[model samples]
Target: MRQEITSYLSTIKNEMYQLTKFLYDNPEESFKEKKAQDYITKLLLDKGFTVLKNYMDIPTAFHAQIGEGHPKICFICEYDGDIKKGHIYGNNLSTSISITAAISLAKVVSKISGSVIVIGTPGELNGGSKITMCKQGAFEDIDAILISKPHIYNIENPKCPAILPLKIVFEDNLSGNLTSMDAYIMTINLLCQLAKGFKPGCTIENFSISDKVCVISLKAPSFDTAAEIRHQIEILTNTLGELIGLNHEVTLAELPCAEIKTCKTLNRLFAHNLKECGIIELETDKCVTSGSTLGCISNTIPCVNSYISILKDKSIPYPSSEFAKETLSEYAQEIGLKAAQALAFTGLDLMEKQNLIIEAKSELIVQSN
Candidate 1:
């Protein structure tokens, strides 16, 4: 079965590269991804998917559906790019195009009972389209959601936790003696310490600082930082937020981040299907947990996210273009194909009601515990 998927993927290599290159060449930020949307819709339509353009009112966001009754699954992605960098991450387009591969395999999707919808959500980097989709009564009745990211260690399974994104701003008169560096360190420490309160192993937080230079021009440097807190225990996210006097702010405090609420039934279906795909490989590294990239959809729909090994320089930090390039290697590409093909088979197992439901439930419980 995996071999057949390999062959199927091979035949359309150019299509994959061309689509990737086109998006890479024409970089769009957030909802501005009209071209990317058109390209994605056109391909899905050609392959017999009922493509819905600008799904959920998100300009570049879309949903493509194939197949009939039974279970209704989805493949969703947050595709907001740094227009300034274009394809800085190994022809950048490849990063997004990787999702297209799953789209290209519409035939396999059709084989599964029920519908398989491909959701191309925009503004993941900034806009938070997933938040919008979840709020607008999206993800209702969806059986499972899937995503394939550009990089990470290919985990047969990765831990997933409830994730919450928050923005913290420190506003006070600086006596006119505050630099961006000073502000950065101070904010990082406070945010890091606050995040630490979210229970040790299960919770994780990532932060970014925004410069509100115009507002606090002369008074004080407004160090606006965004932090995302994730935990298997849903209550922990809120408990951590409560621990910090989020309501207390010197200038302006906004709770920009919130963990996604997922559908319980769909989660079990996905877990069962994944286990059947292959022997579930446990990750050795403690930090390596549930797929952060795919977590966007898990918040709303039943989605399973995992990591594919980085092509090179795993030790390096984020925004490492060099490491991103390594992911595009020929060998890496082969591994990706194998992984995708194996995963395709996983979708088939989902057609069987009992096993699929049980597995997903087990996975959710496992992660929660």
Candidate 2:
């Protein structure tokens, strides 16, 4: 079965490259991936998968299925790229790998009593469409979710910290006590002081200040801690506002991203498949971190966000033109194809082994608790 899947992916490697190149050349911003959605859905339809566009009322999102019954395995595809730098984050390659994996699994799904689903999740760069989909019950029935990203090293699972984006507005009191700018400067000083008392594993990741608004991103080891930090900041800011005769508004800038809850059973299977593909040097550090919307889905279902090496030079920073161009290189394309083959092999195993699915779900329940 592994050989069959490998052969099938090899046969379509050129087509996959072309697909990646097309997405790389024509980058679409988040929530506006009409061209990408059309191209991918047309290809999936031609390959015999039943695809439903406008998924969950998201115009750029789609759901495609190729099998039926229990142990419904899902592969998540993200195609939205950076607005200015194009496919600088390698979403184009990730999307190609996901589609190829699903197609390869579709070939052998008939032999097993399982289903394969490919979900096109857009707006990961800014809006986090997966969070909205998860809220709408998009992943309620999925047994396992598989997704991968281009990284500097081959890793089975990377620790993704919980993050909360907050917006603080300081409105003038009109009593001439102090201007909003004065309040903003005071708030920044107070926030810096407050940050010194934060517990270990918590930090202020980034922040920005405008004329009357300040946006701060808080990061913590867990979602609960992140929310607690946000609460503390709000209280402190409101108190300062009251003392200075300034009205303040605190609100969430976007959805809070939860830290990834890895399903060990699924990650082990994926690691095994990756090793079979000659990717034997896997990074084992749990502290290696990256941000991802997969954290949203992993909170409910078993999920694995594996990493494949896409950059030949390690020092090239991401979101740069050089990084974007690297994604279209031959080496990156081959790595992406290998990742797709590994992901499809993992899917094949999960479909054939019912106990694996049961164990994975059991782990999810225990982890959630």
Candidate 3:
């Protein structure tokens, strides 16, 4: 079955390369991925998917469905690029692999008994399309969602915690002869200490301070953990302000952790499929702690966001361009084919092995309840 799926995907090699290259060459920012959306929609439509353009009323978002009946498996794709910095985060690679995988699976969906859904979610960096999709009930009918991402290891689960993106502003005038720069530096140093004191699976990422404003991103394993961290930060900020005679102000925005309620059976099946597809090492390094749009969907439904390593070696750091290149290279095409094979096999298993999907849904119900 894996070889047959690979053969099917091999037939589309040139087209896949063209599609991947075009998207890579013309990167679009969050919420402005019109061209990317149109291209993906057309490709899926050509493969017999019922494409719903501008899905959920988001201009660049779409939901394409192929096949019919019992179990509905979803392939989540994010195409929004970092227009300013190019595909530095390798979203283009993710987007291409997802679309290619979905199409590849669609070719064999008729042989199976379930639907394959490809959801094109735009705006990972700026706009939160998955949040909107979940709120709009996009994932309500889905049985399972598969997401591919670039990472250092083949992680079935990566630590993904509830994230709080907060902006802290020191509003009061500088005390005595102190300048905003001095206050900023002092505040940052103190925050660094606070971060150092944080527990495992909690981190402060992308902390930047300028003038009287400081922006820090927080991630914790759960909502309660995040709330506790937030409270601690507030207390420490207040203490520092009082000590320096400066006023501190904080504004926070919450993002629900796409806490993956793990289904051991499904994970086992995926791991088996991945190994059969030529991947030797499988690690659960941890759950994804980084913020991902997939988190929003996973928070609402049974989803697996698999991270496949692009690096030939795990110890060395590779350039983002190399990652992008890998997504389109011949080797990448093989990886993409394997990914499709894995998802296809998983979907088939979920549809046929009633107990497996039942257990997965039971897990989601337990987590939600």
Most lDDT-accurate candidate: 2
Please list the residue runs of candidate 1 whose C-alpha ends up more than 4 Å from where it truly belongs after superposition: 1-7, 87-105, 108-112, 160-301, 310-318, 352-354, 358-369
- lDDT scores in order: 0.51, 0.86, 0.73
Q: Could you give candidate 2's per-residue lDDT for residues 256-367 as a string of tens digits?
A: 7888888889889999989888778888536554467778788778887988888879998866778878888899988898899889988888888878988988998898
lDDT of 3 by residue, 1-369 (tens): 445566787787677667777888888888889889888888888888898888889888888888897688888787766665566556666776677777777777787688888888888867468877788898888888877676667787666667778778766663366655666678778778888888888887878876557888878877677778888888877887777777777776444444445656567788887887777588884765466656666655677777877666555344355555556566666666566567666766776676777887787678778
Segments of candidate 3 deviating more than 4 angstroms: 1-7, 174-183, 241-247, 253-258, 287-289, 313-319, 367-369
Q: Model 3 compared with the native: what TM-score?
A: 0.88
Local distance difference test, candidate 2: 0.86
Backbone steric clashes in candidate 2, count: 0
If both were scored by lDDT, which would come out higher, candidate 1 or candidate 3? 3
Mind giving the per-residue lDDT tens digits that candidate 1 earns over 203-315?
A: 32444556731111101001111122321222332333344322212222221333223434543443444444342442432244222434444544456554555455566
